[model samples]
Each structure stands twice: as C-alpha cells, then as structure tokens.
Target: MAISDFFCPQTTSIVAKRERRKEARPGELLNAALDLFVEKGFAATRVEEVAARAGVSKGTLFLYFPSKEELFKAVVRENISGRFKAWNDEFEAFEGNTCEMLCYCMNSWWERVGATKTSGITKLMMSEAKNFPELAAFYQHEVVLPGQSLIRRILQRGMDRGEFRPLDLDYAVYSVVAPMIFLMLSRHAVGACVPAHVELDPKKYIATQLSTILYGLRLSPGDMEPSQEIPQA
Candidate 1:
C-alpha cells in the first residue's frame, strides 16, 4: 500500500471531525446558554459566560446568534418553543378519549419540561419579564399564546366530546394553567423555601389536580364513582 493512502484517510478523518464539531457548536451554545439562563436568570447571565461555557469565543457565538437578545430567543426556541409542533402533532394523533388525553398532556409536559432543567425557563421569564418588555413580548408571542391555544384545544376536545361541561373558555384556560404554573413555581422557586419534612411529589400532585378538574371538589352521594373517589386526608 502506498504511504499516501494511509495518510490521506487520516487527513480526511480529521477534516470530518472538525466539520462535525463546527456543526455542533450552535447546539452546544444553546445548551450552555440554557444552563446559565436558568441558573442566573436572563439579566444576570452574560453572553461571554455562555460562550465560555460552550468552549467557544464571543465572536463565534455571535456568528450564530448575532446578539444576546437573539441568543436568548434561540435558546427559548430550542428548549421550549421548538417542541410545540411535535406536541400539536401528538394531539392530532392521540387515540385516547379527551379525559385520558388531558391526563397524557399534563403528564407528558411534566416528563418533558417539569422534570428537566428546561422548566427554569418559565421561572426565569416570570422573574425577569417585567424588566425586559421586548423579550416578554417575544415570549408571549412564541410560548405563551401557543401554549394557551393548545390548552384551549384540549379543553374544547373534552367539551365537544361531552366529557366536560360547557365552560367560559377564555377564563377556563387560565384555570387549567393555574396548577401548572404553581408546579413550575414550586419546582424552581417556592419549593426551595418549603419545609424539608414536607415531601412534594409532582406526580402525585398532578394526579390529584387532574382528579379535581375532572370530578370536581364537591361530592354528591350518587355522583361519586368508587374509582373516582378522592382519598381522604
């Protein structure tokens, strides 16, 4: 074998590795940015910190993100907003009844977002959005509105199928969202201050909330199914 052939393959391998690394830079930066944004909040996190965490220079970060605001937007898109299309598709393809679908939706959200560090994005936005109006609007447009729409669709599915009674959807969506926001807040912020003796089980909490939403707090003698009975404290 010619010595040139061995050397040529090695050279090609090195070039391929470099190209792969270049392709991965944007994702690395986004992951690093998410970590910092979640830990430090948006205002406190610096662009240089994100680049350094990603093992890249500030200029390289700019090559992809252009500006800090844009970088943050990209991070939000990658972590949160990007999943909406797949979620919507899941809704379309779901085989379960609306009640089961609602349960699946909330559980899926917990698995995907609540159980992950990505949930901190919600905490970050809640704390910092008041100070950054532009980013707040962007978040509203990108995450909040779509999220509400998705929830409305879920509720509407229930109503249309007769699983749920007619509701004032404008207000009902907020009711559905309230517990989720509490869970996020509890996970990211409020849970920190919670007493160590008190165990906060998100899965159990979600189950309880779903039951309340579906069955209501009021129990008529005839209304309670044995399976749907709320366990007494």
Candidate 2:
C-alpha cells in the first residue's frame, strides 16, 4: 500500500482514482474530439465542447493539446496515419497473387476504416481544407502521400509479376483510388440525402469495383492500345 493509504484508506483510494482518470483523459479527449469533428466538422467543433464531452475543463485540454490544431493532428495520427506502417508491413508479407492482394486491400480498408467514423476525416478535409491550408498540407504529407505510395506499390507488384498490363503508374493509382473516394463521399457527405431504394451495399460495390479494375488491368498481350493523354479543349 502507498504511504497515503496507511494514513487514510479512503483518501488514498480517491487519489489513486484521480491518477487513473488523469491517465485516461488524453484518450477520452481524442475520442470525444473525433465524434464531434465528425458530427460537426472541424470549424464548428470548439475545444470547450471536446472538454465537456470528455468531462474535463477547457484549460485541462490545453494542458494536453495546447491548441485545437494540435489536438486534431493527434486525433488523425491516433486513428488513421499511425496504422500505415502495419498496413505496409502486411503488404510486404502478403504471399497471394496481386489480384487477391488488391481484393484484400480494398475489403480490409472498408473493415478497418471506410465503414467507421474515421472515414469522416476525408469528408471533413474535403469540406474544410481550403480554409485550413496548413492542416490540409499536413494531411497531404502524412496521409495522402503515403496512401498513394502504398497503392502504387500494389500496382507495381502486379506489373512486375506480368499479371497486370503496363500502365502509367501515376494515373493508374488514381484509377484504383477513385472508387474509394466516391464511397467515402457517399457515406459521409451524401448518404443521408441518397434515396434508400438505390442505396449501395458497400461490400458488393467494392467487389464490383475490384472486378472492373482487375479486368482492365489484367495482361492481354498485343490486344491493348497504349493510353493517350486527352487533348485540352
């Protein structure tokens, strides 16, 4: 037992409880911030609201995050960018054909991120990035670049194995990514307004997208024409 416990058991218990709460505050704050940021976009979410949701004072939040921008950075790193290394490692260790790998990649992303509140980050960025250029630049550097690089590596792997046809890596990566962007936008931005009759099943949508992309990418020796840049109007 602690010395305080010896002196007064109840006093020690309260102190221990406070210490535990202190330790948990940062995580609680991040969770609260994420929920609010998703529900009310970044500009509308005040630091005070985050602290209140976390059951702390506004001053206490500053003690940990210093600024709203800093808190947001921490939240993005905690929820999204931090996982890139493990994902990249998974790519490196994968033994399947590139088609299987791409399928796994898309489905895994839906499970891990696309179907979660974390997906709101992309919608949030699309809506507010113009006003917060610094944060936008930070996100581009931390999330966008790494994500594109990972996709490029996947496409390159297919090409190297001769399973995928030769294509411009820069443009082809976006071709692979565009469907996912549409999915994110649909879920976070436009889903509420979309009619229920035609609502998409994300799993089926991804399967169809994967089938389409893989068909386009599969090697067909002497049958495919080289891609040409579109002429400017």
Candidate 3:
C-alpha cells in the first residue's frame, strides 16, 4: 500500500503527540531561561541552571539552541517579535481615518507591551544594547524598522488624502513615533511612584501625542476643531 493510503489512527495519534512534545520542549526551555535571566541577570545565569529549571538535559537545550547568545536571541524574538506580530494581526483589517488608525495601532501596541511579563526584559535589552551589538541590531531591524514603516505608511496615506499638510513625510513620521519611544523609556526613570493625579495613561497620552502631530500636519482648518458639540454653559 502507498504511504499516503496507509494512514492509521494509532500512527496518526503518535505523530500528533510527538509534534506537541517537540513544540512544548522548546517553549519550556525558552521560558525557563528567560525567568532565570530576568531573576539573576543574563551574565549570572548559566545554561545548566536553565536546563535544570526546564527539566531537560543540558545537551537537549544545546540541541535546540546552539549557544548562550543564540538562546538569548531566541528569548528576545519570542518576547518582542511575537508581541509585534500579535499587534499586526489585531489591526490587519483596520480601516479608519489615517490619524485615528495610527493612534489606535500605536496605543494598542504599547498596551500589549505594558501587559507582558517581559517588559523588564525589554528594558534590560535596551540598557544592554551598548554591550550587545548583535542584539541591538536584531531589535532595531525586527522591531523598530517595522514600527517606523507602519508610521510612515500612515503618514503617506494622510498626505495623499490631503488630510495632512505637505510636510517632509520622513520628519513627520519620526516626530509622531519618537515621542512615544521617549515616553515608554521614561517609565524606567519615573518609577512606579508617579502620583495618581499625574500618572501618564497610555491611551490618553497617545491620543494627545497623536493629536499634537495632527494639529501640526492637518490640512483643513475645520479638521483642527473638536468633532463634538460643546454643552452650553
């Protein structure tokens, strides 16, 4: 009998079980390594300890990740790239005003990062970038560039629709994005003690930032006005 025609329930079940195990194994190793790295700092965490935490042999960990550096890269890819992919998927079907859509996407992206356990890990990666050129390059290429591209596309659409003024697209895109990056990084310096009254709410903060940019770029005088009726005092 042909191999394709010989499909049996027992064989299929064994193949499915093996596939699940293979997928789970790498994820378990990565999570264990990430936890140790976050807890002990990357330089202090050893591979053997990661293997022990993952309940796998050191050889098996090495089989999946050839080196410590490679494993760290995997951790970054898992935490950072995966988040961006989720954001991209969430907004893939988005159709709205260019400025509003950009703000929505940016706000959602920040919210997701804020919710993740790996936010501290991302902070570590940013702080250690000077010492880790490969990681820095990977982060810029994979995360920053894609984000910039999205921003640029939004600005291009606005400019095309004459919704925004004819400014240098590159500069306008950067202006919109750079402030958000600064605000996100500012959290590390500001600490959790930001007073409740003054604490930066991500959604409102993003809306204000995007509004400021739109104010500068918006083409129509009426577009600058609030879109709601004010109650008569």
- Give the poorly placed runs of model 3, Cα more than 4 Å off: 1-22, 36-41, 82-92, 186-198, 221-233
Scored by Cα lDDT, where does model 3 land?
0.74
Better of 2 and 3 by lDDT: 2
1-233, model 1: which lDDT tens digit per residue?
99899799899999999999999999999999999999999999999999999999999999999988999999889988999999999999999988888889999999998889999999888889999999999999999999999999998888777677666688888877889888887887754646556777999999999988877522334555535646799
Worst 10 residues of 2 by lDDT: 189-198
> Which pairs, if any, clash in model 3?
none
Total backbone collisions, model 2:
0
Q: State residue 158's C-alpha deviation in candidate 2, in Å.
A: 0.5
Candidate lDDT (C-alpha), each: 0.88, 0.92, 0.74
Q: Runs in model 1 with CA error above 4 Å?
A: 1-6, 190-193, 217-233
Candidate 1: the clashing residue pairs are none
TM-score on alpha carbons, each prediction: 0.89, 0.91, 0.71
Q: Any runs in candidate 2 off by more than 4 Å, and if so which?
A: 1-8, 191-193, 224-233
Q: How many backbone collisions does model 1 have?
A: 0
Error of 1 at 218 (Å): 12
lDDT of 2 by residue, 103-191 (tens): 99999998999999999999899889999999999999889999999999999999899999887898999987889988888887664
